[model samples]
Target: MAEVRTKSGEPAKTAETKRPKRADALRNIEAIIDAATRMLAVDADASLNDIAKGAGVGRITLYGHFDSRAALLRAVADRAIAQSDRQLATLDLEGDPRAALARLLEASWELTHRYGALVIAASQALSPEQLQRVHDEPAARVRALLERGRAAGAFRDDTPIEWQVTVIQAILHGASTAVYRGEIAAEDAPGLVRDTALAALR
Candidate 1:
C-alpha cells in the first residue's frame, strides 16, 4: 500500500482545494476595481484599506490581486483607457483628413473632460516605458489620421507629422485646463478645437 501523506505542509489534493470558478474570480477582481474607482472619483487619496473594505474584501485579498497601490491604479487606468479606446474606434475619417482631425480632437476633448484627472494621474505615476505601452499605440493611430490628412493636402504639406501630433496633444491639455478653470464653455469645445487645429496647420 502506498503511504498517504501530503506534500510539504499543505493539504493533499481535494475537491475543496480546487481553484474558484473563473467567473467568480473575475467578479471579485471587477468589484475591487470598481470600489477603487469610486473612491478615487471622490478623493484620489482614498486609503487602500478603506477601498478593500468598501469592496467587501479583506486587505489580504486586495494585495493578493494587485500587490501594490500603483498596480491597482494601473488597472484602473487601463479600464479608463479601454473606455476611451471604444469611443475613438467609432470615429469616421473617410471623406477629409482635416475634418477628420477636427472630429478626433472634439472626441478627445470630451474624453479628457470626463477623465482628465485619471489620465493625468496615470501620466504622472507610470514609468516612461509603461506609459508608452498604454498611450503610444493609441497616439500612433491618431498620428496616422493626421498623416492621412496631410496626404490629402487638408493640412500644409510642409507641416511635420510629429509637430501636428504635438500641437493636438498640447491643445487637449490646454482645453482640459481651461475647462477646469471655468475659462471655456463645454458647448464651445468643438469649434474651439477645430479652429485651433486649423490654425496649427496654417
Candidate 2:
C-alpha cells in the first residue's frame, strides 16, 4: 500500500482512551468494530453511518466509541492484526527452515487476502508511522523466521535480512492484488506465494 500521510487536526481520542468500561458498552464496541471490519473489507470508502447501521447502532453510539473515521479504521486494522497474529501463533513453525517457511507463507496468505481491503483503508487513514507500528509484530514474526532460515543456510544471506523480509511482504501483497484483479484465483494464491517467495529467498 502507498504511504498516505495523516492529516493534521485536533487530536482524537486514542482507541485505549475511548475503550468501553461496562459489559454492555464493551459489547457495543465489539459490535461496531466487527461491523467496521466487514464493511471496510468490501469498500475502503465505507462511511461511518453505514458501519454504525451495520452494527445496529446509531451514529452517536459509534462516535462514542470511535471519534472519527480514521480512528474506526485504525481499530479495524488493529483487530485484524490481532486475530491474524493469534491464528499464526498456533502454526507449527518447527521443521526444516524451508518447510517452516512454506507453512508460514500459506497461513500469511490467508490473513493477507482476508484483510487486503482493510489494509488499503488504513493506508489512506493512518500515518506511515502509525501503519508501521501497527504492523511491527507481524513483520517481526517473518523477520525472525527469515533469520533462522538464513542461519541454517536455507535462505540467502548475501542480502540483508530486512530486505528479504520486505521481499516476502511485497510478494504476499502482490498476490493479494493479483487475486483482487482476477489475474489469479484466490484458491491458488497460497501455493503461488509460497513457491514464489521461496524461490526469491533462495
Candidate 3:
C-alpha cells in the first residue's frame, strides 16, 4: 500500500501520539470531580466558580466538563455507586455466606463513611428516581449475595428475602447516619456496624 497521509499532506497521529492528550483530559475530568466532591460535601451552596478554583481550572473548563452543578453532583453520586460496586465485587461470593456478607458490610460501611458528606449532598440533589437508579446496582449485588446466603441455609428463611434485604440495608444506612451524626465514634464504627449487621441478618 502507498504511505498514508492526511489531507493536509501530514502524517496522521499514532496511538502513542494521541495518548498524552487523552490522559490529560482524563486527569482534568478527575480533578474536576474530586474538587467538586470535596467542595459540595462541605458546602452544598458552593458556587461553580468555587469548584473551578478548587479544581485549578477556569469556569469555561468546568462547564465544558460538567455542564451544570446538578450534572456534577450526579457524576459524584455515580462515582460513589461505581466504587461501591467495585468494592463489593471484590468479595468472595462463593465463600461462606456469613463471611462474604460481612465483607460486603465492612466494605460498604467504610465507603459510605468515607463519602458521607458527599453522599448527603448528592441525596439532596438527586430525586427519588435518580437516587434509586444510581443506588440500585450495589443493592442488586447485595440482594444476590443475600439470595445466595438464603439458598445455602445461612440466612433465616422465615421472612421474605425482600424484607430481610431491606432491613439489612436500613441497618447499614442507619449505622452510617449514626457515624455522621456523632452518635457513634468513627473508630468504633466499623466493628460496631459490622456486629449490628451480623446480628440483624443472622
Best by TM-score: 2
Model 2 vs. true fold: TM: 0.82
Model-by-model lDDT, in order?
A: 0.73, 0.83, 0.75
CA deviation > 4 Å runs, candidate 3:
1-25, 124-129
lDDT of 2 by residue, 21-131 (tens): 344566887899899888888888889999999999999988877888888887788778778879999988887999999999998888989997787888877778767
Stretches off by above 4 angstroms in model 1 are 1-22, 38-42, 53-60
Candidate 3 Cα deviation (angstroms), residue 197: 1.6
The residue pairs in collision within model 1 are none
- Candidate 1 C-alpha lDDT tens digits along 1-202: 0001121234546425533533455666788888877777556787889989989988987887777788888887778777788888898867777777778888888777666666565566666775775557567867888777777777786867887777877787788778667899878876887798789886
The better-scoring model by lDDT among 1 and 3 is 3
TM-score of 1: 0.75
Q: CA shift at 74, candidate 3, in angstroms?
A: 1.9
For model 3, residues 1-202, the per-residue Cα lDDT tens digits are 0111122244455556756755666677788888887887667678989988999988997787677777788878778777867777777767998888888878777777767668778787777986786567667877898898889888877788777777767776787788767898878877887787777777
RMSD of each candidate relative to the true structure: 6.9, 7.1, 6.4
